[model samples]
Target: MDSRNLIRHKTQVVCIGAGPAGLTASYKLCQNQIPVVILETNPIYVGGISRTVNYKGYLFDIGGHRFFSKSQAVEDFWTEILGDEMLTRPRKSRIFYKNKFFDYPLKAMQALLNLGILESILCVASYIESKLFPPKEIRSFEDWVCKNFGKRLYSIFFKTYTEKVWGMSCDEISADWASQRIKGLSLSKAIINSLISPNANQDRAKVTKSLINSFRYPRKGPGQMWEVTAERIKEMGGKLFMGTHVC
Candidate 1:
């Protein structure tokens, strides 16, 4: 064996992926004066799904990642990393169906009006039926949603969109996905919250991620956050090896 071909490296910690979590771990380690190395397969990008793509000078996120968390510590960490570079923007999300747009995190009145009288009545009936005869065993996304919002509402609001985005049938997807994504939110809870007075005690921290009205984003893009983080890590004596794949 050629001695020169034999390479050796040593670090207190080795982080993989270089995505938000990996970068964050490396950053913290570097901050504590610990030697760390980050390995990322993509040579040009540091953030995984959180990366911003530059196409003909137009910047767009790869996965539409948002900077919102139920944890204050996570929020504070983002602020600490980006500081003023983070922009607080009011979230405006909509779903387009049947040549019309409907608000996401759906407003009950707006949804009913948009769905029309007959469909609305059917949806209500479905919800009541679900309440009266809940599924004995919840297995998939379809089951969970049908048990909560009912089959009718799920078809309209969830089925098409979810299938299109995920490229899988709702029945094929795990109930865990629905539970996690729609955590702390249900049709009844949504209606109750909407009916509550505007001045009611609604702590922002306690609000679900889906219901968040505003969120912070890096001025340039979410990629900027990781870019800055990588630089900071480098300055703090951490090594980042891009274009490196780990098996």
Candidate 2:
């Protein structure tokens, strides 16, 4: 690489990666009339994981995203970009257990129907047992979850998937991960809440970041939002160089 042959340019801000954070920062900086350059490693896409993948005639999300943001500014940003193009999608996640699908967020009726009377009884008994004689030392994710949710529920709900995700025994993962992720959520609380309000997440205050009944998404896909945002950035005289790496 010759020094004179190498192209050089100057900007007030040089953003790395055109992911959500990077793109948002560049958009804001350019809006303030500050010169900015965005370097996106991806050659063609803008949204990173949130980018929509299109085939011959099919459209799919690379990694599914729900357009519900805890921040008002984010919500406003989405609205400003897509507006009526956004559609509200209901959450309906299911997990496979014992070769059967179990409704996520624990649908009381579905769990009872799927697990059967005998297994349900055993699970309830196990919950009672855990409460009566919880592990004295709750250091691991397994211990904390077992104490709060019972061994039977933990084995059925959290065990296999957790191991698959982290590639470690339940005891190996830190309890802090569980505590931080599902602080207010517990098996008993979920059961009780279901009996009261089947879809317990009407209020965001009581809901975890992962738990949302419904969320807005662009009609085309999440990529639409970012594409529009990128266009806005370019219109504002922001320099965007896709397929460019920071090295």
Best by TM-score: 1
TM-scores of all candidate predictions against the true structure: 0.85, 0.74
Per-residue lDDT of candidate 2, residues 73-182 (tens digit):
98998888888998898888778988899966556557867998998888888888999999999899999889887788789888887797567898998898888755
Cα RMSD for predicted model 1? 5.8
Candidate 1 — which residues are off by over 4 angstroms? 1-11, 166-173, 192-206
lDDT of candidate 1 at residue 53, scale 0 to 100: 80
lDDT (CA) per prediction: 0.83, 0.80
lDDT of 1 by residue, 93-188 (tens): 799988879987677767888989999899989998999999999999999999989889999988988898777999999999899887766777
Poorly placed runs, candidate 2 (over 4 Å):
1-11, 121-152, 159-183, 195-209
